[model samples]
Target: MTRRVPFAWFARNILVGTLLGGAYGAIHDQVSWSISPEYFTKFKFEQFAWAEIGLEPRLAASWIGFLATWWAGAIAAYAVCRMAFRHAFQDGASSWPLGRVVRRLLAVLMVAMAGGGCGFAYARMRAQDVERLWGGWRTYAGVQDLEAFATVGSIHNFGYAGALLGIVLVAVHIKVKGRVDRSSPQSLPPPGR
Candidate 1:
């Protein structure tokens, strides 16, 4: 029979998983940086130029703060997952293996990516609205802006890549954890025994 895990173990596992996942997400952000492409200059994009914004310390601070925001997002997501599955990892129950925990973690990532993709698509459809809001008087009013932002391209690439990566990671994790033997309550031990 598999050994039981204490309530404290569950708490610890959740906390550690959240922190680790948050860190992983943070690292991911740093890996995907790309410079603005030349195409942006050809179109009526002079108004949105970074040089016009005048780089300021506050801007730098806010950008840095974005990283913390990303970390918090990741941590909160994992925490929510743990809370949602609290009943499954109760004290006196068989402790989940590391591989199982990893599988769950990856599963969450995959779901998040899928959700993000939907959001991305929605955001894309409304991209012109977003540009209008940000551009104000500086927007290209007459001609159709053909030159696309490089960031848009990267966003598309990352969206698909993130989904694929999430699936692969989840698959590997689940494979290592093995499959559920049955669907009955018998699959789990009797409570309080």
Candidate 2:
């Protein structure tokens, strides 16, 4: 039987994952803000009540980003630790380690970012439709440039969807790696770990 995630360190892994996800979200939201500040000014600021607190729009948006996605990282870490570390041991050898787990989850972050970028591009290309069809379109009627606001919203939407998909993909990848390593007799733990 293979070793599961080392219980002692999994909490640390979850913390790192949560922080990383927050950073990604904050950065992504900054980009979205750059593209359409109204997305934050008219929508997110109010939704998060930062506008009421009189915080700077950009700062508020960044906080919103972090709050929105930090949990995603924790979930991702748990899934990765469970799936990938089960393959950690085989034939009295340990293969996957916590460091490797972090790296793999970072790959998941990249995949999610890629999806966000694509969503931004697609929404930009169809800005008019996005603005018209966005669920909050009427709520944001006062927005100076409704299309830009909606495009940014679409970017956020696509990013969340992408993160979910990215996790699934990463899970499949690690599972395949587990299967491959299971067949080999060479999977071994690091010398000092």
Model number with the top lDDT: 2
lDDT of each: 0.44, 0.76
Where is model 1 poorest over a 10-residue stretch in terms of lDDT?
A: 31-40
lDDT of 2 by residue, 19-66 (tens): 989888888888988988877767777687732555577877788888
Worst 10 residues of 2 by lDDT: 87-96
Q: After superposition, how far is residue 17 of candidate 2 from its true place, in Å?
A: 0.5
Model 1: per-residue Cα lDDT over 70-128, one tens digit each: 44344533443343244343333344555556556666566545544554565567666
Q: Each model's number of backbone clashes?
A: 0, 0
How does candidate 2 score on lDDT? 0.76
Off by over 4 Å in 2: 1-5, 50-54, 90-95, 135-141, 188-193
Best by TM-score: 2
